[model samples]
Target: MLLRLLLLICAPLCEPTVVFLRASPSQPIEGNSMTLTCKIQHAPLKSDAQFCFFKDGQTLGQGWNSFPEFQIATMWKENSGSYWCGAKTASSKAIWSQSIQIDVQRVPVSNVSLEIQPPGGHVMEGEKLILVCLVAGGTGDITFFWYKGALGLNLETKTRRSLTAKFEIPTVTESDAEQYYCAADNGYGPSLSGLVRITVRIPVSRPVLTLRAPRAQAVVGDVVELHCEAQRGSPPILYKFYHEDVTLGSSSASSGGGVSFNLSLTAEHSGNYSCEANNGLGAQRSEVVPLNITVPTEDRKELLTSGVIEGLLGILCPTTIALLFCCWLKRKIGRRSARDPPRSAPSPVPQQPTYLNSPDPVQQQPIYQNVNVVSGDEVYSLVYQMQQELQSAVVEPPRTRNEDKDPSAIYSWLKKANDTDLDYEDAM
Candidate 1:
């Protein structure tokens, strides 16, 4: 019929193209091995074309022979999908190509987890810190990396097979603490994840109470000590001590810096002395140190009551000034023996003259009338007699004067009255 109408007029003037080449490893991994050729552009190198292979629309292989490649050794997971290739020519009809989509990955029994959003991984340097990686039982396109201790951070890809994969750190320092994990690859090998340690909290700082006294004069049984510190805290701190507000001792530095507290001094431990450091992120204090307490002159009842009050004022002040000067010299010798006085007693020796004229008295006394007789001689005689008689006896002595005498007998009676008045005037 004119060679069948010249092969349908040369198949509408040579138009036959069924490409589908490229796929050596376009994306294949599950047990690996791939290849998919199938050309046939302008057909007719001897035509009679026969190459086949289609997928999404079924029909894997029905004809092949010249330049029709299509392998897939071992690759599974249903050998993925979307493939194309066709070219029939024994007289034309059927031509398809262009449709390659063979994915197949699946080497991922992964299971990489590492989530920490606001869950106690304790963040505070500046805040905000999330990790998350997940990706369990993966299969096709899946990347997700993110590490931290061994470095290597951020990397996510999950084309359409996701399960989770995040990574943020908007702040959070102190070298970001460290130790975190997550990984998952999908093209096989690489599934890490199981390490999570990140802590960065820091707060407690105002403490600094230092006393340490072995002797700067904190006496009364001394022992003192007390050091407490907190330069830049972040540990198990907790150091407390205070004194005018009571609560005296407590110490616990647990790996950080300072802590002491001994104290034994008494006298009420004087006064104001503070310190507190806590570490749960707050609680500071410290700054009020006074502490006085002193009373040691080698005390022993205060040195025996100051030596018995200075030995009773040094023995009653000189025995009360020598007993007031012996009572003022016994009242000045009894006021000088009552001012002066008394002596008296001594007299009598005039008898001789009396007798000289008395004897005549007796005889002449008889002449009474006017006897004018001239008797000069007789008168003399009579006078004598009368004098004698008159001179009579005189005797008066003993009127008490013997105060136990003997002051040389009153100077020997004034030397015997001046020798008897000069011998009684030479015996008259």
Candidate 2:
């Protein structure tokens, strides 16, 4: 009993066995790696010893294994605490190593990257754009900077403890479509990220259509030009023209601008016209414009005047000729009667007189029946021969002075010629 007591009393002073945990890096920086080793001071069989690690009284692994060391691939501020290890051997009970307090220090920011939300990195106009500045390794408080183009255009500056920082744009515009960059600083110099291109696409706006002609008024056979333009849009715009809902033609502009299409006017082309502008996103149409083809009133008036003049000449020419021929026939008849005076037969009482063509048994033939077939000279010759015969046959009859001077004897003949017994004559 005294020998066992003496051995126990000498064990602590002579061969003191001290179990402790050793850290390769005494002060580990956040986002760095470290290793912990558990060992015994007087241990001679370390390979047979199994060890397990703990931080702030919480086990790091499932349990004890053959390994006597613990490793941490990454370190953070949350892992800064008092750490210890437990060692167990096949022939002894579990033993706890001395605990050590570790402090994780803050590190400078590095490996900065700028990422755009809604992946593929294209954001249209008026949409929200998010720029996230992230650091692969950093610690403690850090300040993030967002910029566009150069440093003169600093978009935002924020200080936080997170490894990532965000800058949001509620509404993106054309000015925001330039190159972007992000930077991070944690007491050291700023770590700037590479340039990232952020393009803000703009959709096509409503188009405006205009019709141009050589004159103020459009007419048939005029070549009219149709101009379609959108106030704002991206490049490579296509323009299409429509007349009365029918497609006329189309044109394209590689750069953002207007386009024109030529149209020939006709009578059938009078109607509403419109144009459409498309940039692949969608098509926008312009307000309808009306086209009217006109025929001048002066031309129609001239044609009407000429037609009226021709129609009047057709009717009046024939009537004018007929009037002139009647006047000539009347004058010729008066001349014939003036040359031959009427003779009257002496009555049996000798005081009464007879006025007739001839006071003879021979009858005078009507001249009107042969007026169209015979000439005026032939008619006069026949009348003169008959008058000579009549005079020779009835020489006892002669005209009185008052009958030769009668003014009513030369008008025209209206009485029947067969009633020649009455010594009456018809005036020429």
Candidate 3:
């Protein structure tokens, strides 16, 4: 039993036992201190023993101790290689512990920067602008976000060394031009950039005005139209039309700028006219225009018979005088002819039956012969009847001899028997 106890004591003196070794802060930052230790497995030997640390087979340092420990000061980033601990005795060589690796990390970035680029001197109403954000140095996933007027507007994430985000404000109005800011996140936390105020400004261009009339000329008591227009201006601009230094009417531009007003025109309405346009910035006045109106006289009317009355008078007076003179001369000549007597031949009875034994005055006178037409039953019957009469006269011997000797006496006797018929025939 004395011999076994002696063996145990002698064995510890010859070689030392190391149970566990440890390193604080498994993960560490660059340029910071750290510690490494080697612990004995059993109660340390009363006789002094040595402990050491090594890296890739190179010895770091040696010391005598109960348990050996390493104090690394100014542990630079280069000290991040593999390392281990060992325990040694005077009687034997050193024994190494299990190897351990160290890590060095970078700090998260803070206080980012922001830059803005607007389209003009100032952001115009209804105009667009852009904002950019930047950071110093950080790794792994990161997020970017933008804000306007305390409201989150955009957010994004990236794995690259640098990140970018874009913002668009369409149809920027007065309300849109406000304070804006941006921030970055690395999952550890978020850091904010600074904020800036935006202002909007615009100038009103030239305005155009127009006029309209009910007719080419505004006559008395006629209704006329007046109008105003602008060649270039923002919509919803209020327009006021004026005439002769008086306001005619006011209207707002809906699309293309134009407005009209109606007025009952009179002779007094003839004058100059103008208009003004405003969009809350300023008002612009148009050039002056002049107008004049006149009234017309009524048309003349004519009578129905005015043309023919003079012509009728000129024709009738000469015709009446000529007809009266002709009738008066004709009556005078007839009266004169009746008053004058004609030279007549003397009667044969008035001359005495002288110079011979004139048997009788009536017998001495010229005998008148007469012829009479007789009617008959057929065309030659008249001839036949006259022949019969002649034969009868011949057969009566006394009448035949008497007619042959005194044919004039017979003719005279026939004329005297039909005197009215003989006188009528003589007048024809």
Candidate 4:
């Protein structure tokens, strides 16, 4: 009866207790170390206890004095299986712990970058950029998928056990260039690598160069800037300058592909100048421009100086000759005017005739005389002869009177007859 009572108390005290398993970083990177922890429900009264861990029905480690811990070394593909742990006392049979399934996961990703053909060192539109996904320590079927913004891109697989996967997007456009991610999976949940930022860098179009000058006649040995410009093109272009069929210098344009050159020129550079612009696609040349310079003439200055001294003498000689000729002509004309008279004048008067003549001989007769008068033959004959004698004379006859008794009467009568005859003749 005492032995039966003692056996019943020992049986109740010898029962086994369980410990729970704990892991750090519940998720771990491949090929790196990880720790698993175990804890006992009750501390053993005696320090003599046995602990053992098993995986897939095989022992992992065994110890006579056991603690609540287990560690796996150099974890590889073979270590990926189910695991469990149990504890036992030295005086009792071992008890089992709950089963725990551990799975060896794939490594996290590294080193993802975009590769391009005719690489611009960046991905851009109208250029084909290859996407490569690589893992350091993994071997399985890989699917190359591309993610853009929020969508996934599926690519056909070429190999099953390849650690690297490649995706080819031919003739990439603007939409293809985006933030991209690639994932590798062998029946494991998707582990996305980092991102590849794609920037579509469009190449510059054909550039055009134009040149200008502030003035048409750009003098030699003078400061001048020749402007070079592009009409339609992308920026960041390089420009080269030329002068007089010879190259001078080079420059770059960042924004508008416009550049200028400041040249302190010499006489040898006074000719055509041109410029060329390029941006990898092609090059353009500006039109040829010409420059000229002017200088003072030495001969012209000497000629002007000599002309000043002789100018007054040359002017006065001709003026003096002309004045002398004009004075002589005026004096000759005055003398001719004084010597000539006008034709309009009156004529002289003629002499008158006068009459006073005594050229012919003449005779005078008596004024009166007395005479007798008878009518008988003797008296008649005497009277007839006296009358005949009186008729013969050319002069006027004398007057006569009675002879004897009346002499005084005869004078008176004769004077009266004379007076009557004078009166009768003057009347006729």
Error of 4 at 241 (Å): 0.8
Collision count for each candidate, in order: 16, 4, 0, 6
Report, for every candidate in turn, its global Cα lDDT versus the true structure: 0.66, 0.76, 0.59, 0.55
Error of 1 at 191 (Å): 5.5
Residues 1-428, candidate 2, lDDT per residue (tens digit)?
99999999878668755678999798998878899998877657556788899999899977789888889987877788999998878877888988999998878888999999766678888999999999998787789999988654898999988899999999989888889999999887899998898877788999999999999988778999899999988778999999988998899989888999988876678899999999887899999999888755774476578778889989899998998788678767755754664444222122233336756544433221111112222221111111122335455657655443324323233233343321223333
RMSD of each: 25.1, 15.2, 26.5, 36.1
Residue pairs with backbone overlap in model 2: 355-423, 411-428, 412-427, 412-428
Among all candidates shown, the one with the greatest TM-score: 2
**In candidate 4, how many Å is residue 96 off?**
30
Indicate the residue-level lDDT of 10 in model 4.
79
Write down the TM-score for model 1: 0.35
Residue pair clashes in candidate 3: none
Clashes of 1: 16
Model 4 TM-score is 0.33
Query: Could you tell me every candidate's TM-score relative to the true structure?
Result: 0.35, 0.49, 0.35, 0.33
lDDT of 4: 0.55
Query: Comparing 1 and 4 by lDDT, which wins?
Result: 1
The window of 10 residues in a row where model 4 has the poorest summed lDDT is 377-386
